[model samples]
Target: MTIRDVATRAGVSPATVSRVFSQPETVAPGTRQRVLTAAEELRYAPNPVARSLARRRTGNLGIVVPDIANSFSAMIIKAAQQEARHAEYALFVTASEELVDDEERQARALAPQVDGLLLTSPQASDACLRELADIVPVVVTNRLLDSVPAVLTESAQATGHAVEHLHALGHREVAYLAGPDGYSNQSRTSGLQAACARLGLEPVVLGPFPARFSSGVRAADLVLAAGVTAVVAFNDDIAAGLLTRFADRGVRVPEQISVVGHDDTALAEMVTPRLTTVHIPAAAAGATATQLLIRYVRGDDSGVRRYELPSELIVRGSTGPVTARST
Candidate 1:
């Protein structure tokens, strides 16, 4: 049914229902509750386009991610939604599936309807990102660009922590499952290498995986061949994949080859042997990016700012002291 139908039943005007959805505090709490109950009973809903036109805003924020299926991105979306709700805004999340073209198209589709955009692991080039920012307020998370604002980037720091954790476990040799060669992943690789040198450990760089589970399978062979005692995966999916592949190959985790993943995704804990990983705050990143974008939208002359949230090394069953036999 329509909003007007529910309005008639609730004895309130259509505007009251609209305000109840968009700006609830403006309506009396009792009246608001009555309208909501009436609308639910009648299954009434308002037209988004009409509401958007009237408000001069879609009352929404756009979020573009390389892949929504990826736990990191999924967590960020959850956080962005919560943050948006706290800010009295709605969120429209989109997945680009790790394609530059798809990301650009999604951004275009979302720009007209939303007040601003929050991008995670953005695939677009700096020039393209600059252009996109001109169209709307854009706050990027995970990836860094010279001209754009970024939040929750922990490539160097987190990678270093992972290496140090493995080192503490008596792993003098570790393999890093690299992601596709991009600014973000490259930074991570570089950081891990630096940490390796500092810890006096040998670092082996493996496949620049497509940041997917299948890539983890491919990486397992490389790890087996290199004879590294531990593997630091670029993300939780790759780490989980490596763990699964290792199991399929009859290689035991922490018994033979220890594994560590980044992102501390839900899958990390759900696995049989809970993954040892770096806990990156993807949700916090989403929330902070929303705050920053809103600040920029409100003309906060905040200088181009960068925030690097803290990441922790989670000691779990997947990682243990290097087997003396491997050494």
Candidate 2:
């Protein structure tokens, strides 16, 4: 039976019935028992998880990611869970596997079950994202939206610094191995272009490879073909892949080719030659997005808000002064 039917039998408003199932602590003991008894007699299952988005304090939040397998995404998810726990709110997380359509579908399914949503590295178009914001409170990270609130890394300047580091070491030409053509890729591209123009260095761009270690391994052959002394990877996963392939081909890092990575994840250090990378504050961004989402849920503010966290390049053994370029 529907919520209204249960409410009528319990002699209470539909909202009260919802609160009884979703937030029983708010209901009087006697009233809660009466509602429970009625639901039992009617054989009604509230399916609380799916119905948690009722118009009351449901104490639940939702989060969506482009790809859950990515280490950067994992870091954000873990941090968000901690923040949600501290706030005494439950979090529901799902991924789109980097598909824009699947991301939209999953988000739409989740919208009705939580008080607010945290979106990380969303691949959805602006129109789709705006539509979702109209349906539920939305806070995004790793991307900037014209209308929706966003928390992102301001990395263009830092990206320039990465290029400058190469230039300082006497490398006049650099290549970039990219991931998807999403907003993140665009941001890096903008930074690279600006840096090259300002420093008068030549820049070469390689494939928009999948953001995976295997993909990077495949891209390693292409990097050697580009004939640049240095290369910047989209992320640490791909950066590690490049190292693996370069080693197999007998291409010594720094001495033959220098490499830079983004999102300085744990893999940066685990590799043979430590990677020089751009550090994105994933944990802080997750916590901050969660805080904003809850604030919106509690009616603190409904207007759009924005946050741009900093990114820095970490130098390591992966890069060095220009050496003889490996053929």
Best by TM-score: 2
| TM-score per candidate, chains pooled | 0.81, 0.83
CA-lDDT, candidates in order: 0.84, 0.87
Which regions of candidate 1 deviate over 4 angstroms? 1-51, 301-304
TM-score of 1: 0.81
Put down candidate 1 lDDT per residue, 1-327, tens digits, no spaces: 887888898999988988887788899999999999998999877677776676676678899988888888888889888888887888988898888888888898888778888888887887878988888888898777867888955667777887887888788879988886666687678889899888887788877788888889878988999989989999989998898889999998898888988888899999869998888888888888888887776678466578888777788999888776656
Weakest lDDT window of 10 consecutive positions for candidate 2: 48-57
- lDDT tens per residue, model 2, 243-317: 999999999998999999999888888998999999988888898999888888888875548888999989999
Which 10 residues in a row give candidate 1 its minimum summed lDDT? 296-305
- Candidate 2 local distance difference test against the native: 0.87
